[model samples]
Target: MRLLHSKTLEFATFYGDATPPYTILSHTWGDEEVTFEDMRFIQKRKSLPEDLRRSPEFMLAFDAAARLLFPPNRDPEKLAGYEKIRKTAEIANRRGHRYFWIDTCCIDKSSSSELQEAINSMYSWYKKSAICIVYLEDVDISFPAGTWELAPGHLTRFAASLKSSRWITRGWTLQELIAPGRLTFYNKDWEPMISKYVAAAAISSATKIPPYVLATGQLHRASVAQKMSWAAKRETTRTEDMAYCLLGLFQVHMPMLYGEGQHAFLRLQHEILQNSDDNTIFAWEPLSSPMLPSIYRGLLARSPEAFSSTSKHQVERSYFTTEAKEGIRVDLEKAPLVLPSGEVYYVAILGSANGTKLSFGDIHHLKQFYMFLKQLDEPNNGRRKQYVRVMGIPNNAQHQVQHNILIFHAETICVRQQPIIPLNFETTEFSRFVLRPDTYSATGLPDIQAMTVWPLGLISEKKEIMIPSHSKDFTALVWLQEHFNSSVSNVQVLLKFTRFPRVGYWCDIITGKQWPKDRDSVDEWRKAIERNHSVKELAQRKRYRIGTRSEIRTVSIEPGIHADQICLFVNIDGLII
Candidate 1:
């Protein structure tokens, strides 16, 4: 760590444990600001006898020579950034602190390793500082020093000034404001406005940070999502710095990838997931209006802007922590709910506040924080289950009052942090439909040999449906519509996906002449098929034949593209079989 002498701006280096206490500065950079290399205030003194060197005569001559060494234009006093350091140094000296750290001139950012370490250690650096000084360039507030309380008039002016202060909206200042145990705010003229302890409430109201959190650097009490929300509105000059600026608040470290753009936030979340199992980390939604497939994104959020509403509520750890977090997977507490349109949406409970039983009844209401999830597809080959968030702006982040919700308790769902777009996001059934034909040998089945499904190239590419492969009972619904001839002879076939008895699938027709609107309407038909054609477990090498045939027409199920998909083929003989 590098420190600047409080009286003289001479720089010095200190290592771990050996470093002395120092005051730190936090301020938004202006159009003209000093940088690390700009702190070039050199005073040269010739070697002299101790008595003579300490004498006023020798000091005057040394000062004159130093002035001649550098031109007036090169003076540090001319830089807009110099005054911040000078004032911070003066305050540090007044507070009996010999050393102070100002970000602009303290660290050598030119060195990559040094910059990385400094960024990762920034939060701790501010936390451990003897004093944290914040300079607000937009406001000029000067009040009585010993009396900490602001008058009613002063309070109004202070709130208005703090509300519009640019320091509150900058990315780096978030951690700087929260990491320090002792902090003071100064206005444009370098006059003290109010100490953090004295104005924590006002500051919290303006900045949306909890008063207690601002008073002390006890970050563990806040959830990862909440901390992230504090940074959601903060702006950083560099695109990646938005995520980089938060290293200290989360207390996790990873190599900085400056060019990654929004992906840096993704990496930050992954890092947070590794360090802590706070489920709120996944509790964010985008602010933009979503397009068809864009709405179906991965569990991980794209950026902190998605967490705009996260800090509004107190999301805490659920009692079901063990279930929510597996060995490495993040499992959300899930319950299935039926919409008015009868679409099944799984409510993935993110994290609950005090009212949950896990809270031991600290508060009255039992609130469950959740987001609506529509299962897109079951976990393919034991991978993460795929789901799409319920589109449209959510009416509420919490579940509706008890009586209105009908929650079917189901096991938790494990999803990946990166995106898991449904396998057939933008494509149609024909694109994903997999069919393996059944070849007959010398069995003398003349009817089967001449069968073929026609117009395969004419299949429309517009139909969409969700398929689940989570268990042995993998289900999918596929439709086959005959080409329109303006004739009643056109048949609409509903191929109900059944068990893959062996290599071949066994599907029963749910409805014959006309397709029913919903799957529930065919409940009795499914039951009838179960009784008449019970699924017989076949040997691995053998295949099962399914589907009833009329004299003129025939329909049967074939092996699909995947174990979870259903593919249909039709054969029309001379008769209606």
Candidate 2:
């Protein structure tokens, strides 16, 4: 680490345990900031080259440094980067500290190893600092005389302005604000604005960072989501620095890759996952409105905006466990079925609804899950109670699946007005629905041929149901085809009769395809019944008028009934009888 002599303004490097107590400067970077090389030339009284002298940033630095060093005829106005550096040194000297560090001039960023070491150690450096001087360049310190004590109204306005300072929104300043033991804020004129102890509440409100963390520097007490929310609104000049700046907050380090773009954040999440098991890290929603068949669904959050509302919630790591053998596997389990064409399909089961619970609260939590449900094509209605099950195929096998499954508990939350306690349904099961290799197409719609639903357990009799692969109303079919589909396979299709909460359209038909042998018998029976006009007319009477509107007509057919006799029957004495 390099520290500047408070009185002499000469740079000196300190290593190991010999480093002296130093004050650090925390401020937003300006175009005219002094760099290590610039400081070296300034210290030797050497004239900068023509190009350097002509540069506005260099001129600004020269003027600010001249004002402090010569002071006798210095301009009162035109203060710039050097003024901040000078003010920091003067303040340190006044406090009897001989060494101080300014980011712009302290570390030589030209060296990659030095840059990486500085960043990885930045949080600790700030925490161990004797003091942190925060300069809010945009805040004005000129108030009416004697009102310096600050009337209640004036204080509120001052606090509000302080809260909105650009100093708090820079990516690098986040750690500087939280890591330092003692911090003092100053305005443009180098006048004291507020201290960490005095403005904790206002700072918390502005940054969404907890006051406790700011006060005690115990950031680990906050949840991962909460820590992420603090950076939700912060930004950096380089995209990757947004993640690099946060290394200290999470206390994890990795090689710095400047040009990696958004993958830097993904890497950060992977590193966090290795050291911590906080599932809430995955609990973020996209900032843009969610769409069904969403493109944003993934294991890592795209940005900090996803954790905007999670700052207030307390998350327990114990809520998640790796008890189930299937739980530990990162890959989705492929369905164990083969297409009639003798082709294999790859299935990837993303997430299931069986062990998960759902509830209604602030729209925030719904948005979080909705963000996770990016595979769906439509956004969930915020007003309704929603339950989502997410499933996906691995990228290698994604082309083999028609569409990923997004199973909602019901069509609308109002159908089950009473909140389902624990929200776990015995019949709910999630499985990957891989499409036949021959049938897979980029433009093809998802169908049941490529997907299958299985029962959660053997508590109840299960049956299988097949439908046309090109069906658009699969959500409705899954609900209405419950009984008929249940008798053939172990899968229980649980569908409830309810009005469409979003739109008033009603589902009328519960369609299913029987097994080959059973279908043949039904076809033969239908032909035998149609041979009689009386039986045919009775069967045609299944159509009914449901609503008051003349156009509202529905064809309601009860499954397992043919010619007014039960079509599906089992006799204890003789099964065929």
Query: Residue 189 of candidate 1: its Cα lDDT?
Result: 89
**Stretches of model 1 off by over 4 angstroms after superposition:** 40-77, 145-152, 289-294, 319-328, 340-342, 351-366, 393-405, 417-577
Q: Write the per-residue lDDT of candidate 1 for residues 1-577, one digit (tens) a residue.
A: 9999898777889989988989999999885566666565332232356787789987877656656855544545577887888899999999999999988778788889988988998998999999899999989767777654655566667878988989989999999999998998888988877878888888888877898898877888888778888888889998889988998888899888789998898788778877776777767877755422223445677777888888855645652332223122444565655433233566566543222222212222435556666665666666556555554422331223223343434344554433344423321122123323234323322232222221123223322223222222333333333322342222323333322332233343333433223434446545544554443542112222223323233444332223222233332222112
Considering every candidate listed, which one attains the maximal TM-score? 1
Tens-place lDDT digits, model 2, residues 187-257: 78888666787677777878888888889999767878888998988889998998999999999999998
The true-structure Cα RMSD of candidate 1 reads 13.9
lDDT of 1 at 569: 34
True-vs-predicted CA distance for residue 262, candidate 2, Å: 0.8
Evaluated with lDDT, which candidate comes out highest? 1
Q: Which portions of model 2 miss their true places by more than 4 Å?
A: 46-79, 142-155, 291-296, 319-577
TM-score of each: 0.63, 0.55
